[model samples]
Target: MKLCVIPARGGSKRIPRKNIKEFCGQPIIAYSIQAARKTGLFDHIVVSTDDDEIAEIARSYGAETPFRRPAEISDDHTGTNAVVKHAILWFQENGTPVDLVCCIYATAPFVQEDYLQLGHDKLIQSDKSFAFSVTSFPFPIQRALKITQNGGLSAFYPEFRSTRSQDLEDAYHDAGQFYWGSAKAFLQEHELFSNQSLPILLPRHLVQDIDTPEDWIRAEYMYKAIHSSI
Candidate 1:
């Protein structure tokens, strides 16, 4: 069985009720659920959340909430891996053996079905443990600067200060949208950022991390701009 799990716990310190918060005219999670359904890629599309309202909204969007996430793993400090592993274990206990599992972020309003499909295809075709979305940094990370204790600017890499922007290697970050992993890899809690994973590169315009109020405002503007252009 192939499964898609979205871990949306209730305790979002940064943005209260963010999982169900409206974005672009609908609950943000609706976008993730819709994207998963549109791909027609999973045997089951489930939302692993402890919040009753979140579960209700998820089901309303055609996603199943068969089980409530445990309070221990639903806390703020809990990582996504634990939530996904718990979901996998639940299915295994119910006699449904999942082969491939994709964990889609509940806030990923920009997640595209094509990228989800590409991640699935690449994970299946390659020997990698996982495949997920990533996007290049707008600026070269090699010459990044930091503020000193006394408030003076200092170069993180003094040697790279002389390097031209074109000479620096490109850096990419996790797009925080979705992750496709084999059941074995997820169950083993394999690190997602290592070389064992394959990256599905997304355009910078399509990637946004909505973890703060400022980020939320920026994302809303970005979303509006992108949709307007289309």
Candidate 2:
């Protein structure tokens, strides 16, 4: 069975109650839950969270919270891989064996059903073991810069310093939205990306990683603009 896991820890240092924080009139996590359910792709939508409020919000959005994440896995220093592993183990112990696993972050409010279906379909069609969303860099990454300790600026890609933006190859970065992979592969490698991994490119407007307040505002505006256009 395909399982979609939304890992939301109680302790959010950036935005308080980030998972349940309102975004465009709905809890941020609700967007992902609704999107995932809209696709009807997963056999189950499980939320693994340490916060009771988050669990409640998740359940309100039609996601299942059969287990509360352990405190050990709810810390800021805890990696998502560990949380995912713990969730898989919890299911195993509960007699529900999952065949495929999709890691969907609770903060990604802009994730759409089409993009998710694309990733799932790609993973199922290809020999690759994993698929995830990505978005093209707004500016040429070759033109990126780094600030030195003494305030001096340095080119991130020194080789491309002399090249023009148009001459540089296109590049993409992980959208930080979601990832899909075989449960067996995830258990064996303890990672979503193995040798066999595919990048599913998404429109830049639909991709936003909300980490800071500024990012949250931008996401809100972008969401409005996109939906209004629709």
lDDT: worst 10-residue window of model 2: 186-195
lDDT of 1 by residue, 1-230 (tens): 99999989888888999999999899999999999999998999999999999999999999999999989998878998999999999999999999999999999999999999999999999999999999999999988899999999999989988888998999999999999999999999888889999999999999999999899999999999999999
| Candidate 2 per-residue lDDT over residues 1-230, each given as its tens digit | 88999999888878888889999999999989998999998888999998889999899999999988888888889877777778788888888898888899999988889989999989999888789988899999889999999999988889988888889999888899998888877777644554588998988988888888999999999999989988
Off by over 4 Å in 2: 190-194
RMSD of each: 0.7, 1.4
lDDT for 175 (candidate 1) = 97
